[model samples]
Target: METIQREMTVFARRARASAGRMHPELSLVSYTLLGHLEERGGCRATDLAAHYALDKSTVSRQVAALERTGLIERLLDPEDHRVQVLQLTDAGRQLLLQVTDSRRAAFKERLADWPEEDLRRFADYLTRYNGWTPPAAG
Candidate 1:
């Protein structure tokens, strides 16, 4: 368990550093938020906060920054007139595509020498690990 934790920490740090190098203006949080917005089409700030287990204030700050940079915009939710949902703009989508491509290329290069079976096993392990959820707080 300790080894797993240490490896995950190192992996996260390297991933963040790589993402920073790819886009100087984007933090890992913002990049992840943008990805979420893209996937969901649109969702409320509160929804993002809940989904990520993040504080509303932190999500609000990132949303405000994205809004200012024209990466994301608030739109009135069709089903809920009182709620505003965040959506990515064309620029946001384009930037995300570029970043994703860069990341994929980097991963491919890093894993070029790995055997196919090793890659498959590693991917399966990652999926299983990601799917595990902690018990709810009592």
Candidate 2:
């Protein structure tokens, strides 16, 4: 377990570093938040914080940065004029698509020589590991 933990930590660090290089202005966290917004159409800032298990302030900062970059915007919820939701702008969608393609291409190049079976097993293992749920908090 310790070995797995250590290796996973290293992998995560490297992935983040690679992502940073792919887009200097976008942190992995921000990219992830953007992806979530893209996927969900629109959501509240509080929703992002809760979904990512992040502090509201931290999410707020990221949202603010994204807003400044013109990647995201706040819109009034049609059903509830009092509420606001975040959504990606056209520019944000385009940027995310480009970055995603670049990342996928990089992954393909890095693993080009690996056999399909190995790749399948690796992906399955990652999914299994990620799917594990911790015991409920007391």
Candidate 3:
């Protein structure tokens, strides 16, 4: 368990470092938020905070930054005129696509030497690990 924890920490650090290399302007957190927005077809900032288990203030700050950079914009929700949801701008979509391609290429290059079976097992383990949720605290 300790070995797994240590390795996971190392993996997270490597991912963070690679995120900077992939796009100097996009932090890992920002990239993650943008990806979520893209995947969900836009959502409220509150939803983002709740989904990611992040503080609302943190999500607000990120949303403000993205808005200032023209990467995301707020639109009135069709179902609820009182509410606004964040969506990626055209520029954001393009930038995300570019960064994603870069990351994918990097992964492919790094894993090129790994055997197919090992890759499959690694993928499965990652999926299972990500699916886990800790039990609620008493």
Candidate 4:
């Protein structure tokens, strides 16, 4: 428990520092949404809201900000015009790559002295932590 808590704190500090340096508009939620869009190609606002367990209005606002920055593009789904497909624009993809690379560089620098076994164990634990079984999609 202590280790997990410490790990989370360290991650938070790193993320906060990076976000602060990157832009005043950046937040944890923004980063997370960017990640989802990057991974999923295009997503609906409804799906994003459901997955994040957030209010539609809040997600809409975040999407608005991303759109304003040209990070994401909102499109009407071809198959279903009623639904929106939120996709990362080219700028957004580039930004994602840059941020991920920067974070990795910083993490690598910090873990330079760690033993290989410790690094492997940490990676295994994080993989497990990130794995989740979603409830049936509606």
Q: Pick the candidate with the highest lDDT.
A: 3
Cα-based TM-score, every candidate: 0.95, 0.94, 0.95, 0.80
On TM-score, who's better, 2 or 4?
2
lDDT of 3 at 86: 97
Residue range 99-136, candidate 4, lDDT tens digits: 77766787899899999999999999889877866688
RMSD of 1: 1.0
Q: Which stretches of candidate 2 lie over 4 Å from their true place?
A: none
Give me the overall lDDT of model 4.
Answer: 0.86
Q: How well does candidate 3 score on lDDT at residue 95?
A: 92
Residue 43 in candidate 2 has what lDDT? 99
Residue 121 alpha-carbon offset, candidate 3, angstroms:
1.0
Alpha-carbon RMSD to native, per candidate: 1.0, 1.2, 1.1, 3.2
Worst 10 residues of 2 by lDDT: 127-136
lDDT of each: 0.94, 0.95, 0.96, 0.86
Report the C-alpha lDDT of model 2 over 1-138, residue by residue, as the tens digit: 999889989999988998898899999999999999999998999999998889999999999999999999999999999999999999999999989998899999999999999999999998998888779899
Better model by TM-score, 1 or 4?
Answer: 1
Candidate 4, residue 18: CA error in Å?
Answer: 2.7
